[model samples]
Target: MSATPNDPSTPNTPNTPNTPSTPDASYLVDGLRFAFGTLTVVPVRVTRWDREAARGGMLWAPLVGVAVGAAAALCGVVLLALGAGAPLAAVCSVAVPAALTRGLHLDGLADTADGLGSGKPAEDALQIMKRSDIGPFGVVTLVFVLLGQVAALAQAYGDSWARGALAAVVAATAGRLALTSAAPAPVPAAPAPRAPS
Candidate 1:
């Protein structure tokens, strides 16, 4: 059911006197640190891993993408300027992110493919994904997806290297923004139970 105007939980309503508050400055910084540390090879120290910090981190994930994408775009631009072919430039663009992120997203994609391809029950699918080894499905998906990325970027670079770089930035930022958007909102804490009489 849709929330009513009178609902106490409805946030940011014009009439609602108590809307949800934003994270403090310190928490915001912590969140950004967590996002960078978790998502990239950039060495950032994140001391807070609590729920609040997690929400902050999730909110900040897309910002980390800006840095990642810029770095990747730089690699491609530099390669192209150094007399590298479009294909080579594309390869470097893709490789830069994989190296920086330690192939974390690629591994996730593989695991997801394995799980879906198994056509098993949830538990079995989870087990299949948990295994360290990549199955046929994972291998196929990774190969094709990586190839597709390279091909697309190669085409883009052929059109204009600057456009390819800009595309890289946009793609990376949008991908991370998707992660942030998909993150579950933080739930309020439950009150402690009253002592028995």
Candidate 2:
């Protein structure tokens, strides 16, 4: 899994034959729109009140949603400008971004539903997430979520597509982040109690 100097394609890697590829600026820009989890970094420069938890690493998550919405609006306009039918534009608009992220949020969404919604104890629930198998909950959720996304894209088609895309990204990021926030952080290693004589 480790990239080495021998491989020219390694990202941010030094001493390589190939120049590092530049990440898509819009992707980077869209990522900063979050309040937690630093994966998506769409920077908005808006003031955020200090959070009580360890939410500092990701201050852009919410902004991603806002940005996605904005992106969606932009996409809509561009689609309209291209004069391509609404269906084509809507499909193409989201294809690149979704492909880039590799549908990570969709997987997470499925896993959360399967693991948390399963009628089992907490330990068993945790076990489900580790398994690769999908359950009824994951399937149902995936279907409806994708449907909702498509519907949203269609609805926002006539308007600003850029803003709409940004909004969609934000929605996806925020939903997953909420899933993340629901889980408890691993407990600190407990100090061993001294054995009494």
In TM-score terms, candidate 2 sits at: 0.51
The candidate maximizing TM-score is 1
Best model number under lDDT: 1
Pairs that collide in candidate 1 are none
How well does model 1 score by local distance difference test? Answer: 0.83
User: How well is each residue in 108-136 modelled by candidate 1, as lDDT tens digits?
Assistant: 99998999899998778877888888999
TM-score of each: 0.82, 0.51
The segments of candidate 2 whose C-alpha lies over 4 angstroms from its true place after superposition are 1-54, 64-76, 93-97, 159-197
For all candidates in order, the CA lDDT equals 0.83, 0.55
Error of model 1, residue 164, in angstroms: 0.4
Q: Look at candidate 2 and tell me the lDDT of residue 94.
A: 61
